[model samples]
Target: MENTATRLADIHANIARACKQARRKPEDVTLIAVSKTHEAPAIQPLIDAGQRVFGENRVQEAQGKWPALREAHPDIALHLIGQLQSNKAEEAVALFDAIHSLDRPSLLTALARAMDKAGRQVPCFVQVNIGDEAQKGGCPISELPAFLAEARAAAIPLAGLMCIPPADTEAAPFFAYLAKLAADNGVAGGLSMGMSGDYETAVMLGATHVRVGSALFGVRG
Candidate 1:
């Protein structure tokens, strides 16, 4: 594994620099080390370096490792940052500390039922298809208002907005737009935009949570 601590420090320093430029506190932004496709041995070093938040892409992948990882470090906050299937709602509710892919009514309903059954409310970041890309797995920009409203009505805790800008394009506008959407809707859950590539930009634009993967964990196999 790459030297996890050094990479984390570099990412944190970059985040600090971005926060400074934006006049925001570095502490205000949560850095979620995306641990999807990485094994527990690889993730442990980051934990040792004081990284408490992690993002996993799949329920099954996370399920395979996190339970054991969490056993050793109970303070770790695991987040679901990938497209979620309704069938896995219950498991996702039980496993993840937060959900960052709540984009559809059916998934929302499934999560609500899961939360009710589990007696735990996992905060969620509604993914917005900001680029209007057909292949993306986010709520279309047009449907966000009603979707957020539906989430609220279902009593799912909203944790701000999340988005992935179209690959290989300037991401600033998308981040800024997401910030505006959050403000317009009175969303106080904090924006969950940003990743390894454009996390600094995301931070400058008011991202409260950034999901970074390769930079910290090295490129996946």
Candidate 2:
């Protein structure tokens, strides 16, 4: 518990420092502690440490854990930061407070229908394949404009853009490109880029939300 609290403080301090350097408010940048694969016992300490927002990877994995956690801490905002399958749209709509992996027309359509059925409009960040990696789950750079228009047509509450830069590379350029893409497309929501390693850089580059995992939880064994 002490370690968790200390790490949380350190991360917050770093974020504040980065924000100060970038002339941005720390409050404007949300810190989403990526809690994927971590159990409740491990998570409670962070909650106790006053960390509210968390990001999960898979719908099924999140379903198995988050319900009870949310019951205890209703203010905790759970975000789906992993690739979402079209079939799980309804469950994703019901479980997640925000969706950060919205990448395709079919999934967009599914989520729209789910929102309509549940009378809930969850904010979503359209994931961009910024590095254009074939295995990554994001809309191609060329398709983002049309995709954004399609998402708007479907009425998915736009919460800005998201991306995972190719691994083993400097992430700043990718983050800058994502910021530019959002600006060019008139996306007025928060930018959801950055993870544990480069989150501070992401904040410096105009990231509104940073998804951090191992840094907070320690290396997963």
Candidate 3:
């Protein structure tokens, strides 16, 4: 069995190699270890090994795991990486440092209410359905300007954009398009693109954050 330290070291090394191949400094990319579906026991070792940031796909799962983890590791930064429902916005806003899937107006309104109630502002990424997949959740790229304007009016801090490229599509173009969209919109800070398989390409195209799960934790059971 691979020990936690060794597994973390191997994952870090792979990240370094990926950064080098993209001609990017390793520190330029933020690795968001997706911990959705994994139990606290499965994650505690990595936390002990010094990983302070994690991503979760569901509010309930995160709520379940975070209290214990937060008590144990006060410095951890939790991110919400899944499609968020309007009703769950309050819980998500209170828990996550960053919300990476702001796809609809109702969700945005709920988040705004949550933020106002909490007296805090949460950094958020407007998810762009770059592939235009009917099944995906995101504000279509064509409607971004209006969406962003509304978000701004609501005082939600729009930090950047997040996108998932279509399966079977080359990653470079998709990443480049995300970068371009962010640039064109004057929000050039956060590009949360790429995952385990295409992160190197994403880094090359200017992804500030990459969500990696299987590549770091091995195949999910």
Q: TM-score winner among the candidates? A: 2
Off by over 4 Å in 2: none
Q: Candidate 1 overall Cα lDDT vs. reference?
A: 0.93
How many backbone clashes does every candidate have?
Answer: 2, 0, 0
Over all chains combined, what TM-score does candidate 1 have?
A: 0.97
What C-alpha lDDT values do all the predictions have?
A: 0.93, 0.95, 0.89
Top-lDDT structure, candidate number:
2
- Per-residue lDDT tens digits for candidate 1, residues 2-59, read 4879899999999999999999999999999998888988889999999999999999
Least accurate 10 contiguous residues by lDDT in model 2: 1-10
Per-residue C-alpha lDDT of model 2 across residues 1-221, encoded as one tens digit per residue: 33998999999999999999999999999999999889999999999999999999999999999999999999999999999999999999999999999999999999999999999999999999999999899999999999999999888999999999999999999999999999999999789999989999999999999999988998856
- Mark the regions of model 3 whose C-alpha exceeds 4 Å error after superposition: 21-23
**Model 3: worst 10 consecutive residues (lDDT sum):** 3-12
Name the regions of candidate 1 deviating beyond 4 angstroms: none
Alpha-carbon RMSD, candidate 2: 1.1
lDDT of 3: 0.89
Better of 2 and 3 by lDDT: 2
Q: Tell me the tens digit of each residue's lDDT in model 3 across 1-221.
A: 67767866776777688788878788877888899999998898889888888999999999998898898789999999999999999989889999999998999999999999999899999999999999999999999989999999999998799999999879889899999998898886799999989877788788888898877677855
